[model samples]
Target: MDDKTAELRDIFLDATGGEGTVTERQAERRGSLVDVDDPETVDARLRDLVATMRERYDFATDLETDAYLRLIRGFYGDETDAALADAVGVDAETVAWARLDCHLVRDRDRDDDAPDAIRERAVAADREATRANDRFRDAFVDLLTDADLSGRLTSDSREDGLREATEDIETNVSL
Candidate 1:
């Protein structure tokens, strides 16, 4: 394989949890369909792999994932929900819900209230804020600005970093 093809293949492999090198489990399931000479085929497979990754990780639907990925990649700077949605080709509501699911954004509520009510309130507040200031629009941006976390999520170390972060949060759980 040429350098570029190898690199792209490695990227998709890692993105789909292959860790640069295919695992025995993957071989069992996918059976090594990659063709180094066929870059287009590889690209198609990579796209499919990314779709599967998005579904498995629950990163939001395809539109939301595209938007979130753009935000994380720094393509959109402090954009409001509508702007981001337009940029990503999804609705503002989809972006809003994805932000919450990704844990990289939150609304303006801190009271210790019932979970459902708090969520509803936060969503309503976020939607209104988006419509009003547009600055207050869906994503807060800074929530996932930590370099370590962002680096991990953007690179091959995503699973490990996520695991560590989750463990840290679990340890810090007060109750």
Candidate 2:
């Protein structure tokens, strides 16, 4: 098309000695869109998070994101919080804080009653961590995870989850 392009194409033709079309390549799948249900895929995503967004979320525990993956794995695997704490070398309270920070609420009370609210709690809890208020640190997980097992978080409630989380956090969790 242009002089620079023609020169590069001639160089490519001489080097490769081919008629000219280069094969396109596909990328390895990653990110939220990918369903990480399998164990290997889960580990890859966790490692990627540590590399990319470890600082992005004000995580409560000092454990590496590599270790926190175990916490998340155990959590979704339905492991008890205490057991997860032990696995991740932290106390159970730290486990709860991490869960809330990661937006993995297990509250049964608000499942059906306030489905979208559950997603908002994830955002709010991280903000609360930024405040470093002992009160918020102590109460948020319990407040979010209260009540016996009931329904579950709504699958489609995350469209505007961030804005809702900010408003709800400011309104309800005043220092």
- Candidate 2 regions exceeding 4 Å error are 1-38, 108-123, 126-175
Model 2 lDDT on a 0 to 1 scale: 0.59
Question: Which numbered prediction scores highest in TM-score against the true structure?
Answer: 2
Q: After superposition, which runs of candidate 1 have C-alpha atoms over 4 Å from their true positions?
A: 1-60, 73-76, 109-175
lDDT of 1 at 89: 76
lDDT of 2 by residue, 32-64 (tens): 322433457547756664444455555656777
Q: By how many angstroms RMSD does model 2 differ from the true structure?
A: 17.0
Candidate lDDT (C-alpha), each: 0.50, 0.59
- Clash statistics: count for each candidate: 0, 0
RMSD in order of candidates: 19.2, 17.0
Candidate 2: give the clashing pairs: none
